[model samples]
Target: MNLATHAALLGWIPVVLLLFASLPPRRALVAALVGGWLFLPVAGYDVTGYHDKHMVLSAGMLAGAVAFAPGRLAAFRPRLVDLPMTIWCAWPFVSSLANGLGAYEGGAAVLFNTARWGVPWLLGRTLLADRGGVRALAVGVLTGALVYVPLCLWEIRMSPQLHAALYGFHQHAFDQTVRWGGTFRPMVFMHHGLMVALWMAVGSILAVALWTRRTLRDVGGIGMPWIAVALVGTTVLTKSTGAVVLLAVGASVLLLADGARVRALLIVLALAAPAYMAVRLTGEAPRTAVLDAAARVASPVRLASLRFRLANEEQLAAKALERPITGWGRYGRWIAYDDQGRAATPDGFWVIALGQFGLVGLAAITAATVLPVVRLAVRLRRRRAAAPGAGPAVALGVVLALFAVDSLFNAMTNPVYFVAGGALAGVDVRSLVRRRRPAAAQGRAPAPVVVAGAALASPAGSAR
Candidate 1:
């Protein structure tokens, strides 16, 4: 590790610990997590390949939650997703048997990988499970964006020296920072420039959602609309093609939504990319026809990239099927190897999940992420009128849609993917809770459930 990375870790860990002692459980939890992801050292700071920052604050927060806020423990209680994740978590250890790397190495793979898979989503979901918590999270994210704006702008001019300047090493291939547009993309503290752009995109969408819902007006000081505007600008300047498109779509949805029942639309949107992915990865997709159709809107170079990417996924999927149920396991087990045993890196997140942990891993995550989204949509189908705080749910769906698009090509393993997943699940889960309450207390007839999500940028009681 570089001197700067060591220094940054020494700094953030203590600060997070202090906040744990001084701040409220939820606030401290959120602060430690949000702060860690935003400002801490990058990926090179690893404990035997695991990012120590993620393990320390993220998984640590859940343990802290159990000790400090036991009553809110229901947040960690898995409903539909519990079983699959159990399998997902345990399979790495089992796969180690076939691809055995011995006890110390194998155990470390399972232990750290589980922590990585669990921490980010758990921290967000556990702390931000309730209405007030979700709103706080929205505001926290916006504030992070507001804080990051100047840094993002400066990095653009300076050509992304923050990671190198602060951490003493770049987190990704420097060549990858090259943009299709004639400029360098900024990485800042985020591991990659693409990650920075996606982070900005998610923040801008949340800000735009808050602005459209008129909840930001309640928070005094700098105007919420201005914050959204600033965040949107940063997302564009980040020079990530996917993120810019995602932000524009989210902003358009928030601005143009007419309070109609969009449940069917949300389901279709959520399922589209995943379905297409499943087909393509399984070698059933009409690649030529689809690429030809897409060529009308894309350049030949982009189309070739897509085709080549799909081909890579096909090779990786075949490799995974050798083990099928349990997968190839760690030690670059999932990556395709040359005759010399040199590994070719896999591209998409789904293929990554399939290769490392098998279909079970993929299924667990899908259940955790996609099922709740569809369930929420189905539950909300009958409601012709918008609920009090349905805006956040709509916003979450839009965020998920954009994430779905990103997941088609990239692995959804970063902080943003887990944070957004937990946010969506936590929001929909409230509706699931309301469905089971007594009719008198619910003040409405029992149905499947239509969680209004959280108040988002609005006050606490806005959801209730």
Candidate 2:
């Protein structure tokens, strides 16, 4: 919206180029995706179309990938796992055409949607489809969150003014930033305080998981244990109860659960969004029970907020059912209006997808995001030993599942999850877990034990 915002948004193109030119393709992708998502202005320009920073970043990455990592792209063979994302990208165009918007509109929608969702997944699949690449991504996220620590703390102490101070506008309502008896819930560069909270919480979970697995000990010279503590403390300071709860659940699973239990939990989390949608559409949302449970723990204001969201979801569900198949197209066609003709807004992404693209679209998007985790879960279930060296991938799968769970209540979309999903989609469950033959059986000395990036001492007490 402002000069600085425009400059930062447009300027990221060259930054993407520089990253690719200077770093490895996978690392470049990670840096470009994470850095742009974190610091770029939320607004975008409408040169030919409404090209936001997300599209711009994806475009730059695509170009960089084409020039630098063409082999990855050339060798890409579409599999059953890719169908959901392909459909997710293609369905918008179909929905547009179904609503009589014609091919031009449909084609354009396809391009934008693919860039928003597909390109990131493709990049992850091509560039980060291995064990080292997966760890790099996990580290990239942890590093990005660590980078946000000071900015978040500053915003928490001083109010969420960095966006306004730097970009010449506040990204969201100022009142939303005030929480916990006037303490600040920092938004930093994200669209909402909750997003920042979720980011921090996820980082905290990864820090702990990686540290415990010994996959990572230090990020940029700081010890992982201290990094975990800082991230955990900052996540709590963000004042989002939901994100904190998710962090707790993820950490608990990683710490306490065995392979089977973790796999089961991942499946549940993966199914949560779809199940909620189905329940809402069938008018069996259990609103009263949910509200009663919320009432026990939530303040009156928070309780009212939940009640309002549920009520709006019911109204929106009714409206979405009018079209049923493809639902309404873009603009405000999918939105319900009251007697005063004011449009009702959707708070959750699942409802928004249902309204805009109907069941087919919703399922496509859900599968695109959630299916990879399900597949990874299945693999882990079958091969329990893979769970050790697969810490980063498992952490990513957990985050993806949590992203699905969060989509039920909030609508924040980060392409990094797609990156993680794509990685999981292509990763071999046994990639990181190396099998060593017994010394007696092989008539030779045993090899060193390495799991999750850390090497265990061999029989002679020497680390590899």
Looking at candidate 1, the ten consecutive residues that score lowest on lDDT are: 447-456
- Alpha-carbon error at 429 in model 2, in Å? 1.6
Candidate 2 lDDT by residue in tens digits, 360-464: 888889998889988888877535523446778888988888888898889988888888888888887777565545557768673432222333223221223
Candidate 1 on 198-260: residue-level lDDT in tens? 878988987777667755552334666677788888899887667887788777766765545
Q: Where does candidate 1 clash, by residue pair? A: 349-411, 431-451
Which regions of candidate 1 deviate over 4 angstroms?
2-4, 44-53, 63-67, 74-76, 98-106, 180-182, 218-220, 258-260, 337-343, 381-388, 423-464
CA lDDT, every model vs. true structure? 0.64, 0.81
TM-score of each: 0.83, 0.91
